[model samples]
Target: MIRFHLKCDQDHAFESWFQSGEAYDKLAASGMVSCAMCGSTKISKSMMAPAVSTSTSVTPPKPSAAMLAELRKRVESASEYVGSKFVREARDMHDGLVPERPIYGEAKPHEAKKLLEDGIPVLPLPFMPSKKTN
Candidate 1:
């Protein structure tokens, strides 16, 4: 996995992972690379230092557990939990078969990829706890 920081024509900055430098190049050339904020295809790689090790003791900052928990809470509270129906619900909404609203749910990796390929906007939320069943 290789991550690259990118900027769109509107100056929206975001990061995305590609399979390789060749993959990124191919995508960019084909206009597949786009901005996360504005969905602009006019993207360019931004300056970022290589993640090579300069010292053995260097460490990255870790996010607090409380912060992750808070983020998870906010996401759950703001979105409807569709559970396993996530892919279907998202597709329905995108195709105008259902009303569009904030939603969150489980999808297989391939499902998410298919959604993107179909131009249905979907984002994966990080640090999501298991869905509570009652």
Candidate 2:
């Protein structure tokens, strides 16, 4: 499947997915494509740059461990560590039961999924090392 950004004569911009470029051309030629916003049939491909892929598929450079550690330290200082009560605190904040503030902690995979399903914003902290227990 291919997606194309389309614009109508009314200058209404929208996107539509097509099976192929030929399919898009056929649809546009037949005036089947219409603007989603203004309902105009005069649709054309909008200006967009093509994504260029490297032939050798060069891997992007990753941040050093020290950089990640420093970032983690900064986040820990800025956000409250709720530990095991992450889900409860997150739910409370989502429901307006608790004052909203920056928080970070541990949560089970299913618990995080449930929160996301419930329309709550939850982001996984990447490159955060586990705390060492005494």
Q: TM-scores of the models, in the given order?
A: 0.54, 0.51
Q: What's the true lDDT of residue 102 in model 1?
A: 70
- Tens digit of per-residue lDDT, candidate 2, span 13-120: 766666567657865775556664555778889887776776888774565677566667765655688888889998998799998776778889999878877766
| Candidate topping lDDT | 1
Candidate 1 residue runs with Cα over 4 Å from true position: 1-62, 132-134
Model 1, span 24-117: residue lDDT tens: 7866875656664555779999999887866678764565687557657666755688888999998998788998777788889999888877
Checking candidate 1 for backbone clashes, the offending pairs are: none
Q: How many pairs of residues in model 1 come into backbone collision?
A: 0
By summed lDDT, the worst window of 10 consecutive residues in model 2 runs over 125-134
Residue 61 CA error for candidate 1 (Å)? 4.9
Model 2 score (lDDT): 0.72
Model 2 clash pairs?
Answer: none
